[model samples]
Target: MSAPDQLLVVIDAVARRSDGESVRIAKDVLCAGAAVKLCLPDTPAEFAKALARRGSRRPVVIGDDRALVRAVGLLHRGRELSDGALSLVPVGPHGSVDLAGALGVPLGAVAAARAVLDGAARRLDLLVDDSDGVVVRGLRVPAGPSGLAVIEPGSVWDTCRSLVRTLVRPAPSVPTIRTHRLRVEADGRVLSDLDDPVEGVTVLSRGGVAEVVVRPRAAEPVRVEASAVTISGASFRYRADALVTGPVWTRTWTVRPAAWSLTLPAA
Candidate 1:
């Protein structure tokens, strides 16, 4: 049998504690229709080990976005993502598993689990950073103050939470999407230089290239599609999905076109 027919379901511990009911539901649903091997990992180390030993079974991650990202990151780092063919069942606190939903994974515990059993494998794009970190979701450089300010806004309390997830320190007040000086280059073409203040930058995976948008402080949004992007300037942080990483002086990310595959609802 192929990996999808025989599954390895790795349930993240946080998801267990936060919402055991959802986790249990996911387990029951997945087990009902497939040959399942379930593993509940307490630490990240154990989780990585589970994935490493997944063998020929499709790995269905039962947790929030962070857990899902962790699994994808591990497979990417190990150079196994090209054939990983992962699935997800979002079971966590509210607003935490938004990435899965955004990716078209069912939010409900039962529906998500069922999808895992019946969904079709679809190729997805990814952003691989120079640091070797993989971004399964889109990248965002939220418009911050003059200094380094990063935002991870995806919920109702975006402004309040964005202030807290800053690179240096929280802005005193939610400044009206202030300017940040960043030198952005997409495919070697300069979209914005350090001399030109920018509101921020967003790079979303599109087919084979990333849709790069540089929000200039004074000019219209500069847009381009590139396989690689380089950003340099004063130290700044950025949100790569659930993680807020950086404060680095510079960074580069190249699109790994159709780098990985996911199990989404079958048409």
Candidate 2:
């Protein structure tokens, strides 16, 4: 079979160490008897421009999780995510699991890279924040660890002890769980106005909403049957995956169906 003639590929340098092997593998498998241009991008802006200006071809990114997210974010905001196709090679340690897990990228860099060359794209769900930042699955937000959970702060001796403990022992646990006072509105109707902080709220389409997951203290899953949703809170900040954006009193969010297309291993 003949390989496609036009392909646009970008790699992030920061994510290079983790992605280096995969990048090489992609080049090896993809470039073999094929015409291709692989670019190593230093900044997200450059990647965005390259992705936008790409000529009649799908875009592939080789970098850590952030690189993949950034690429998606750009396409989403440019109104290109729904129409554009994306391929990912996990490179960085941080956020790598989240990225790979969400996108179904293989753990091995080479395997992930190979998926790009051979994978097929499918319409999928994506979350958009106030800034239109894109998150594949969801976010994790927790309140700071309580002071008693750690050594005392004032006394020099306590400080020394705390420092040692901090070095040797794990840091205080940031609450893995939280609930937010959310006012969820789908389409235009209010679905919830919970006063208690409930588990994370997911605003997706009907089919997407059916996939909603609530944690230990599960609250009533608010059905957001609309094309858009709005979330607000005064106590806790929101974490979109690894990116923390809002402590706002309120923020609006929307779910656009098939807003992004991701390349996946054919079934």
Residues 1-267, candidate 1: write the lDDT tens digits. Answer: 564589999999999999999999989988898999999999999999999999899899999888988998999999999875899999887778878988899999988988889888889999999999988868888523322233445654878666668756756685665788889999899989888998889998878899999988778998899999999999788888877787788889999989999899999
Q: Write the per-residue lDDT of candidate 2 for residues 1-267, one digit (tens) a residue.
A: 343445677877776665455567766765663456778767777777788887766677777666777777877778776655787766665544565555677756667666777778877777665776666655543323321122234667867787898799876678555456665555556555666556666433334542333232554554324445565555556555445554566665555556677777777
Q: What's the lDDT for candidate 1? A: 0.87
C-alpha RMSD of each candidate structure in angstroms: 5.8, 6.1
lDDT for model 2, on a 0 to 1 scale?
Answer: 0.62
lDDT of 1 at 144: 30
> What is each predicted model's overall lDDT from 0 to 1?
0.87, 0.62
